[model samples]
Target: MDQQFGEQIGNNLEVYMDYLFIKSVEEDHMLRDTVDTFQQLWKIIMKLNLRKCSFRMEEGKFLWVIVIKDGFKANPEKVQAISLIPPPISLKEVQKLKARLVAINRGRDVAQNPNDTEESIWCFLCEAQLYGAAEARKQFLEVGGDPRPVMRQAYNMFKDGGDPEKLVDAFSKGRESEYFYASLYAGLYYESQNEADKAKVHIVASCNSPYGQRSDDYMASLAKVHCMCRNWEL
Candidate 1:
């Protein structure tokens, strides 16, 4: 709940709400008081500035739908709703719902069907979703699947001796090393141009990573880098 995050949520409530709803309630099958749930959904709808938006329960299922006054063609009505059978009660069922929603929101191709664009997109989206969540939740072990796209994003951000705060923000919580290291290198570029304090910050952050295994090899590599800068010893 950083101030910037609050502002971001305010700015892109639609996207964030979609994500939040998917992550917290819907996916998890966590039931809220019926009125409160609708109220929360209504809040998000308002933020989207939708002309016509509402939800309904039919045949013991919930249907959340949105209709922009004059947006797209066939589906000017972009609808996404959770078809709830009843109030969720079991933790196990909730977990399944969570997993399914995670797969859907992330565009993860859980089915492994290459011909399906939705599946591929879902898979990639799922990866991006997982990437963000893992960072926030400090779950680095889960981030080892594919580093290509993630690295690419980090690299672009690292260009031209990127901002330390921006790099750190993008690095995620427990998985700071990847971009933290990238930022350190980028910061070194600044250091070479006489930005010692900035370089020190990045290096120190990496040296104190909460995620990277503090293995001897990792520590030694960090020690060497620190030594190179004549900043810290051992």
Candidate 2:
């Protein structure tokens, strides 16, 4: 059926199992492209369950990820689920928590200390102090491995203090393009503080960054940042 429809609609339609994605490069041509694809579907005797279908949407969930005009996003429900989990108490619980974090992060390796014991993991989860700028900077410098995670932690520290400039400067020493999530966090922090112009600059940069263009998680964050900017305008 896909081959038959592909012959008719050309490159405008994509099919996976019973799912179909009708797309067009130009917004002006989208309606016509959808209509043409549907006509082809009808000719091939393909039935669509309209209740399960969406059309002309700016964004929607597909395969558990939010698909948007610019990119894909992590599902908020999944993020919330991870956040709601109780802190690990036992070794088994810590392992479970580690597994859950890995899954939520799309299989990205969860940070683990080489010398960590089960008790240490539990303490790290339950007794970790929220750092201030000085402590965050100290951690960022001392942990000279992946700067991205350190920058994120520092950005969050600044964000909690309503300091967007500090958040920006936290990652400015490195390539800004490499820390798209930090930039987006800074943008949101600025937006929360009613700094629309500053927020706009960071949000736009985040949306267009190489990481944003390539990673689904960043894309999802971009979708949220876009919505926040739109709402601010309204």
Candidate 3:
């Protein structure tokens, strides 16, 4: 983490702990207990003077550990000190840093399209958008480059006056992973047509199409539809 950002993290944690302590407790005893524990923890963190932190890859995911000055490991006991420490830098931040580093450190390819057949450039562009690469994302979408070809095809089929129900049918036969996004778009299309029932059906189907990146968020939004309407299950 950069020195500037670390300072911001330390400040936020201190404020968060304070906020938690001041919030109502009588109405929610559990809240009070949790706040108390965090207050104690924050005190310990303040004592430890934390410095650099690194994220290590474990089981295809990232885990962060703080490295204090002079080979000391920042632990829970160093609550107050840790509280003063900034939040652990996220992988998303790391990727942004990497992109910036590449832009500055590596030579640019002026060539229209370099020969990198091994890598799916479109997918890389998708990853860029997913990682908050706004400029690249704008360029990618501006060129009508849809990384998700399956969804694009389905949409084209719809634009060509294809049957909406059949569009849903076609996507239902897609890979389970594709079903959620496809259904999400399909749901929107149906909803616009005043087909609330069909829209609900497609939205619920997408939510059930194997939980993925935006799946939980989508499903949570549709929870009322699920509970109230008792719509399609799986």
Candidate that would win on lDDT: 2
> Per-prediction count of colliding residue pairs?
9, 1, 14
The sequence of per-residue lDDT tens digits that candidate 2 reaches over residues 65-169 is 666777567889988998899988986577567745543443111111211122222222222223223332232211112335534454344423546566656
Q: What is the TM-score of each candidate against the true structure?
A: 0.30, 0.35, 0.30
lDDT of 3: 0.41
Which of 1 and 2 is ahead in lDDT? 2
Worst 10 residues of 2 by lDDT: 107-116
Colliding residue pairs in candidate 2: 73-220
Task: Tell me the spans in candidate 1 whose CA falls farther than 4 Å from its real position.
Answer: 1-146, 157-161, 174-176, 179-183, 211-213, 216-224
Q: What is the lDDT of residue 91 in candidate 3?
A: 58
TM-score of 2: 0.35
Q: All models: lDDT?
A: 0.38, 0.54, 0.41
